[model samples]
Target chain A: MADRVLVAKLGLDGHDRGIKVVARTLRDAGYEVIYTGLFQTPESTVTAAIQEDVDAIGLSMLSGAHLALVPAVMEEQRRAGVSIPVIVGGIIPEDDIPALTKAGVSAVLGPGASAEEVIGAVRGAIDRARREAGGSAPEGEPGGSAPQGEPA
Target chain B: MTRREEWQKAFEKAPLRDADFETMSGLPLEPVYGPADDEDAEYPGVYPYTRGPYASMYRSKLWTMRMFAGFGTATDTNWRFKELLAHGGSGLSTAFDMPTLLGVDSDDPRALGEVGRCGVAVDTLADVEDLYAGIDLEKVTTSMTINSPAAVILAMYVANAEANGAKRANLGGTLQNDILKEYQAQKEFVFPPRPSMRLVADTIEWCAAEMPRWHPVSISGYHIREAGSTAAQELAFTLANGFAYVESALQRGLAVDDFAPRLSFFFNAHIDFFEEIAKYRAARRIWARWMKERYHASSPRSMQMRFHTQTAGVSLTAQQPEVNIVRTAIEALAGVLGGTQSLHTNSMDEALALPTAKAARIALRTQQVIAYESGVANVADPLGGSWFVESLTDEMERLAEETFSYLDDLGHGSMLEGVLQGIEEGWFQNEVADAAYRFDRALNSGRRVFVGANAFTEGNDEDPIEVLKITDEDERRQVKRLAEVRSRRDGDAVERSLASLAAAAADPEVNLMPPLLDAVRTYATLGEIMDRLARVFGRHVEQPSI
Candidate 1:
């Protein structure tokens, strides 16, 4: 079964070229990608993430609001009790990466991330989350099938 | 046959260099252009404006170097504005933060974590006052890149200038009050397309009567192109939107000449040198012809298409950041050759973050070098007679005309109706998305080469460039200021003004600018004014598609 991933734009930034490209990239890589469109609040994004029951969440923020917005998303994830891996991509400053990583972001992709880098980050984060879950079935995987190998 | 045969014989006798001989957009090129390729191109400032808009071009008055600067608090951005002016920038172009651009207040929950980050935070007229504290609004022309709440922001500017003793009539600048592009590309819209357009028309109508030197709408292709559109799509969609604005103003009973002269354009000077130049030349020709023949515009000023050009932000690569300076220089040169009235060169560090002060100055210096050091400005449309350039210009015109025909048929012969229907059905968005995806696929497949991203990537990893930081303190200070203004202003006056504004909004007959001015004068916040209008007009939520 394909690993389902949720992609969202949190905050008022409407620069969606990066997010749309990433979503298509993930979809082309055999992941069933769900995208929540522009101007999504943190609560709305996390709620969609939980309801969709995806394996990972990719947040795209280009408005330089990630420092404030990402932490809010993390808090929402904790409150919702969903321990999914969260990855972020956009124009993120290097100095802020430590704080974002400390806040539990699995990986941070900057602008112009190659397709391989994007896929690798998501796959690595998902594998880490699955291992942390004691190799349990992904909570919402249909028929409880084990995760399949990466598609070529 | 005599001159042509002689030139052809000479051209065939010479050895050609080993090069791609193709444009950045993959348009095939000829080795040399000659008089045979000429289409009897008009002189500069002539009808159709194919050569250039003004007779002298940059020889008499060089293009205004308008740097887009804003971040942190009003004070921070004001300081930057002063620095830019001191550093020889000819004009000011304001970049409002996301919260302000989306018409939300600093304290609004939706504005959390995004205050004054992307641009300056303006919650009320007070912020405008602080933003231009020492700058003389009359002496300097300002261009505010805000839409959706554009009328509100314009009202603030007007009120701020008046408070500072600047005559409203003498004030000059442009408002990017173009709303159709908001629905199509930028996605910063507050209300539905119809009412949002009404706001645009209201501003145009009000500006026509009051502000003589002010441009009510800067029909923009910059954001459309930035949203991953092809060069042709950018040209077509932007011109179509310009026609729609003209139609809307005419529908408001204003004469074509009365308001059309004040309408301006903004375009993107992407990395494609000849393609960008052709796009500009084609845009002016199309606009001039349409205004004169279709709209029956008699005034030459009404027929002319004047625009400001900005270097493509999307073209700036995050890798090998310094290379962006070279990229910007090439793009800025294209703007100059294409006859832009004003220009803004993107800083090298923009891909990583907002530019630091040094980076911003360097971007300005890139323009200075082109304007002064480079000899390109000495001749108006120096490439006007080139076979390659003339052919590309004609090809762009043909492509844009085809788009106009399709849109006209869709709108039942009305460009305005066509754009509205296209936005409603998501046709424009889908087209842009498909183009963007195609480009991405080409890039991934190594068919397209981006310098550091795809090819020549040795030593790509380097120390991260230092970026401008907007700290939490900026947000805190802005919110405090907002609260202070709210507490000190006359509560009754705010209510009355907002009430009147709401009443005017409900009536399609009343122009919303006067009441907007009244509300801002009473310290009514942007959020309050926008919310009041949203109650009557309703908010717009796009149907998202992949």
Candidate 2:
């Protein structure tokens, strides 16, 4: 079965062009992508992520509220007892990357991230989470497989 | 042979370079244009306004250098405003933060990390007072980019200016009170489309009677284009929204001329130079013709379409940050050549974060260079007669007209109804999403070349620019300030004013402006006022779609 990923836009920023394109990119790469639309709070985003039972969550934050919002999402994930790997992408600055990473973000993609970079980040995060979990892939999902077709 | 035939013969005799001769929007172009291509000979300040809005464009007065600046708290942004004025910025354009834009207070739980993040945070009239501080409201025109809470913000501005001894009539500026685009592009809407549009029409009606110099609605295509729409989509959707606003105002029994003159436009100056220029020209022509013929607007001022332009923020690449200055310069030049009334250039560091002071200065300087150093501003519509430009303008008009026809049929011949129905059906959102996906696919497939992104990607890893950061302290201080204002103000007055505002909101006949002004004067917070209205108007939650 293909890996399922949930992409969400948390916070009040409505700039969804990046997030929508990323969703399509992931879906085109054979991942069953579910997108949570605009104005989603961190609590709502994590709830959707858990409900979807996806392999990973991709958070798109362009409002410059990532530092406060992303950590809140991480905390929500912990509270909900879901150890889902969360990757973020948007207009994130270089200085904020370490902090986001330190706060348990698996990968941080910038605005100019290409399709390969986005796919690589998601796959790497999922792989890292699997390895950390003693190579136990999610129930019926295949463990180590490349995305079907490379983005042309 | 005539001059046209002779020029055609000469044009064919000369060899052309082996290149794709087309406008950025892919409209094919000819090597040279002659009198045969353009025979209208319309001058500036004429009917249809295809050439330019004013007779002596830019030669009499250059376009206002309005920089969009706001971050952290009111005091922080006020300092930036003064600095911009000191640096010769002709006008002020305010950018409210997410919470404020969403009509919530700094302390609201929904605000969480968003307070004072994207733009300035305003809780009450006190924040507005601090925002303007020493800036003379009468001398300078300010444009507030707020939509759902635009009427509330306008009330605060009016109360603040009056408290500062500024007459309401003498005060000048624009309010981006356009709500249709909010449902279509920017998702900061608080109430549903019907009530939200009532707020817009109320503001326009109020401004027409009270603040003549104030522009009630800046029908915007900037956010639409930024949301990944094509150039033609941007033009068509924006003009359709403009027509909707006009219809809304007319429905309110206001004469077309009474409020149409105050209606303005805002467009995105995307990287496609000729395409952006053509969009602006086509915008004026379409607006003029529609207002005169369809709306039966008799006044020439009502027919003219004056717009403010901002350089496309989406075109700025995050890979080579500094190279954005060149991109901004080209876009700003397009705005000036397109005869914009005001302009805002994006900072080099904006793709990552809010612009640092230095980056903002460079962006402002980009506009200064175009206004003074570049000779493009000297001639009104310098590209008006070019074969490529004229043809592109006409093509843009045709494309926009096609969109209007579809919308008209959808609305049963009413543009306003069409837009409202389109928003409900998610047609606009799907169209924009499809366009954005196509662009991304083209970029990924190497069909579209973005410098330093898809091509010429050497040394793209270095990040040298310093981005301005809004610390948590700003948010905390803003919350504390809101609390203090709440505690100090007369609690009874706040309750009474909010009650009256709510009552007025329940009644469709009562214009919400006066009650909003009364509420803001009582120090009722934006959140309180919005919540009261939401009780009656209801909150809007869009049906999420990919």
Interface RMSD of every candidate? 0.9, 1.0
Query: Candidate 1's C-alpha lDDT?
Result: 0.89
Residue A69 deviation, candidate 2, in Å? 1.4
lDDT of 1 by residue, A104-145 (tens): 999999877889999999999987888777756654553222
Residues B1-546 of candidate 2: C-alpha lDDT, one tens digit per residue: 543344344344445433454554667654333244554465566667787777656655789999999999999999999999999999999999999999999999888888899999999999999999999999999999999999999999999999989999999999999899988887789999999999999999999999999999999999999998999999999999999999999999999999999999999999989999999999999999999999999998998899999999999988888999999999999888888999999999888889999999999998888766655565557787788999999999999999999999999999999999999999999899899999999999889999989999997978566778789899999999999999999999999999999999999998999999999999999999999999999999888888
Q: Please list the residue runs of candidate 1 whose C-alpha ends up more than 4 Å from where it truly belongs after superposition.
A: A136-152, B1-40
Which candidate tops lDDT? 1
Query: What value of lDDT does candidate 2 attain over all alpha carbons?
Result: 0.89
Model 2 lDDT tens row, A44-149: 8877766666788999989988998999988977776666788999988888999999999999998888999999999989888777767576645534331232
Location of the lowest summed lDDT over 10 successive residues in candidate 1 chain B: B1-10
State the displacement of the C-alpha of residue A104, model 2, in Å, after optimal TM-score superposition: 1.2
Assess every candidate by TM-score: 0.93, 0.93
After the best TM-score superposition of candidate 2, give how far the Cα of residue B271 lies from its true spot, in angstroms. 0.6
Per-residue accuracy of model 1 over B110-152 as CA lDDT, tens digit each:
8888998999999999999999999999999999999999999
